[model samples]
Target: MRKFYSTALVGAMASAVLLTAGCGQGLLAGDTGSDEKKNEPIMLGMLIPQSGSEAAIGPYMSNAAQLAVDEINAKGGVLGRTLELKTADDACDPQSAAAGANKLVTAGIHLSIGGYCSGATLPTLPIFAKADIPMIIPAANSQDLVDQKLKNVFLINGTGAQQAGAAAAWMAKDGATKVALMHDNTSYSKDIALRTQALVDEPGGPETAILEAVTPKESDYSANITKVLAKKPDYVYWTGYFQEGGLIARQLRQAGYTGKIMVGDGSVSPKLIEIAGPEAAAGLYATMTQTPDTLKGAENWIADYKKKFGTDPGPYSNQAYDAVRLAAEAVTKAGGTDGEKLISALEAIDGFPMFSGPLKFTPEHTLSTGGFQILVVKDGAFALQDALQ
Candidate 1:
């Protein structure tokens, strides 16, 4: 169900310039000489999962990026040039992501945002690197992404290490003496799970008894549930998307294992309750990247997003918004859009207010000190359990 606004509506809402090489020669025939130069548009590509299992989160991120561009253009765009976002659907698949990356490069896009899935983003990294196009990943948090050290890639979301550290600290504070770690075997899932295990297993930290890996597409997890139950862990932390996390939570409860269950940001979606049923999802805890609705300084952004999209914003919407805004700010600071210049600008960002917090990049181009908020399922909805500062 793709919803497209009227051409007039799109133009009014966003000063979009749908310019291709030879799409409208008649419209530009009369506007010769100097006027043509003034109307030229700067293109920023967006590679998102518009069709796939992860598609639910993609459109929100893309919309957030568009919102930032619209706001930027409304108040005198970069170098007096209007910024236009050209979107390509990667479907959260590696092959598709590579194709999308190539398409954007061919379309002459210098900067881009998106790729929510790490598996998809990883394959496309070389494509962006070869083209010298800078990509600001809004939601991919796999540690391997940074470990690869691609010169043109930047991550707006905190890494798996950050999430795992916050989660381990919270669990330890909650008196979880023995914890079980479960992952879906994907790069993002396994990385966070392993990190959390290491944190909990450290000397003087809480003891971790079990580390289990499960296929994400498996429907039945009774065997795994039985194994986890046998361990008698005080808590179970699952690192995976909503699909598997919901199923594991459901089966774990069904198998009479009632430990304190927690999940990473992937399981924070409302759909988890629907998949696992409200009773099964009850008391489940999750750590998520800050959201517009949860953060104090996001009221204006939430209002504007609702006004523009006619819906509530998703969990990562603010992160995507910040990603685009930070990219634009970086481009401005660099006085140009070259890859090296933009990378330096991104690293040099300091004390900028974002939906997350006062933004400052570490030497590695990661968030300096912000942490994830812990949420628990209460009355069939995710409620804030503890605010992380």
Candidate 2:
């Protein structure tokens, strides 16, 4: 009987060793710790336009991302390990963006949130795609971006086609005929303006009077403004960033073109009002992915953001905030930090509540549905005009 008991004890000990081996393999495979104390912090990367022409809106994005990380850490973080942010500036240029992407790739960061300019984001696409790193773009909205079929890139903000459709509908409703199209010739600006113009020229659509393209860095648009005014358009649509848009607005108003004006998401900056002057910028309409002063269900976020950054959130702040939150959520749901595991978690997300709208990615990693809001400049601030479906 004693011999039989010893054999049974040996069998039990062997089973325990097998179980331990299985658990260790699982932990190693998923980069998870068997105990809370052994868990390592997860690193998240940021690649925003911290300098160059797009710098005015960069800090708000960075601050919003920081706020998301801080809030998640305060709430015990993802899987009990802190989320670490490693930021690299893209400078809103393609070459610089590529360099920043390579730096992040070398540092072993597979998840990142940023890239404000499509021009800058375009060159980095290959870098991230080859490395299989998942990048969540918060604000780059050019239509051609997702056409590359990169498996790992995702966009929280809707595409240029979405915004262009909204803008076309609003202009048609407002009785805009003989519309003039102005763009800065950048991939993003020109794509938005051209797509919007195409929508306007569809069957039963408004007539396009003028289509003008300008250099982004040109200081004086008097020549282009004069050409647009010669068309006598009832509405002038400018698709470009804030600096160029403000310059064009001032030049157009000065050139005595007295029709309604509209700008795209690129011009939705507070500094636009200051640069164009309140009177010149007043009554201008814009379509944006988010508005700082008018986001619904974001009062708490806004207050917290202000408290932390000592400034109000900007246009893409909510989207950037949502990107970080969604990343954390994926990490927690996956129960670990493995890139493939996180990708699966992200794919499984549906109706994840966020400051923007329900968070869900299409098969191609685009937002399931385009989400944006119409905003109008009033009294030196942005007011929500309506929600676009």
Which pairs clash in model 2? Answer: none
Q: What's the lDDT for residue 126 in model 2?
A: 84
lDDT of 1 at 263: 94
Q: In model 2, which regions exceed 4 Å deviation?
A: 1-38, 49-58, 92-99, 175-178, 184-186, 205-210, 213-233, 241-259, 269-280
**Candidate 2, run of 10 with poorest lDDT:** 1-10
Per-candidate alpha-carbon RMSD to the true structure: 8.7, 11.5
Scored against the true structure, residue 104 in model 2 reaches a CA lDDT of 87
Tell me each candidate's TM-score: 0.79, 0.75
lDDT of 1 by residue, 241-299 (tens): 99888898899988888779999988888899888899999999998877766665456
Which digits, one per residue and each the tens of the lDDT, describe model 2 over residues 1-389? 11222233234334433544556346655445444243567778888888898888788888999998887787666655788888888999988999999998898774878888888998888887787677788888666678888766888888887788788988888889889999988888888888988999997858789899988888899988888888899899898999988888888888887889999888988888888898898889888776667776567678888898888998689788878877877765665666676778788888666555667898878887546677888999878886664
